[model samples]
Target: MIVLPWPPSVNTYWRTFRGRMLISAHGRDYRVRAVAAAVSAQRYGQAKVAVRIEAWVPDNRRRDVDNLLKAPLDALAHAGVYEDDSQIVELSIRRAGLDRANPRLEITVEGA
Candidate 1:
């Protein structure tokens, strides 16, 4: 699976912010783990956030997982989680037997 550098605060934000998306996509039903890493700070009473995301998809539905990433990303962009031009730092996909012991789609995003 893609293991990203997720800070505690960012994890909380994602759990709340993407909770609906996760539920809508039946995330809990899938035997997969999705993670996000981000930098957040408050300055002058304004919050600034930057993020990176890692999504672990199952071997059976790599294509479906690819499609699934689009919506939440768009939603995050719309919500200003990161800049529109945020770049993807890395993407790696590895194949393994069907189980949580191994991951299929390992994606990492940076500058977002």
Candidate 2:
């Protein structure tokens, strides 16, 4: 399992410009992936996996969990948890709760 800081929304990590040469939301996504790779301890090459995302927020509020998934999935791919996010055949996401001191995202990947 790998735990990482909460990633920005997909809207923030993915952007498009009309015929522009920009990639990965101006490299912000790449930076997040780099961090995930730095923290990852294991890598899986071609196995079906299950992913669980526990998002800890600072307070009790309504936030879209789905919006927070893409970046981390991409990060796991970059971290070499699997060859690609497509290997994650099962997924679970939940709002873990408030963490006044250290609100962040926790990701767990297991062979399925």
Candidate 3:
């Protein structure tokens, strides 16, 4: 299991400046990847995986759950928690309600 601060959506992670896609979201990818790496379970050579995400958000904010999933999945891969995100056989992403003070993501992984 790993927990991380909420990340920018994939939609918000890039920008088109001068008509070319560029990384406009600063440090999030690196931060997510680094945090995952530090806490990695090191589950290597896994054939299939199950992922559960409990996304925490503010009271008035509505986040697209699908958009929020990509970053954490990529982070887990980069952290070597699993061989690849393609190995995920079962996936669950849910909104666990509002946390006005601290908005974050809770991720849990298991072999399937």
Best by lDDT: 3
The 0-to-1 C-alpha lDDT of every candidate, in the order given, reads 0.33, 0.74, 0.75
Compose the digit string of candidate 1's lDDT tens values, residues 1-112: 1332211122222334544523333332121222232123111112233333444444454443334444344333433344442333343333324545443333333332
Model 2 misplacement above 4 A: 20-30, 33-38
- What is the per-residue lDDT of model 2 for residues 28-96, given as tens digits with 9 covering 90 to 100? 655565455446456678999998889898667778889878777776777677889889899999998
Error of 1 at 36 (Å): 11
Candidate 2, residue 16: Cα displacement in angstroms equals: 1.7
In model 2, the Cα lDDT at residue 56 comes to 91
Off by over 4 Å in 1: 1-54, 59-65, 83-108
Residue 10 lDDT, candidate 3, scale 0-100: 85
Between candidates 2 and 3, the one scoring higher on TM-score is 2
lDDT of 3 by residue, 5-61 (tens): 777678777778899987565535655554654374747566788889898886666
The full ranking of all candidates by TM-score, starting with the best, is 2, 3, 1
**Two-way TM-score contest, 1 vs 2, winner:** 2
What residue pairs are clashing in model 2?
none
Q: Quote the positional error of residue 80 for candidate 1 in Å.
A: 2.1
Q: How accurate is candidate 2 locally (lDDT)?
A: 0.74
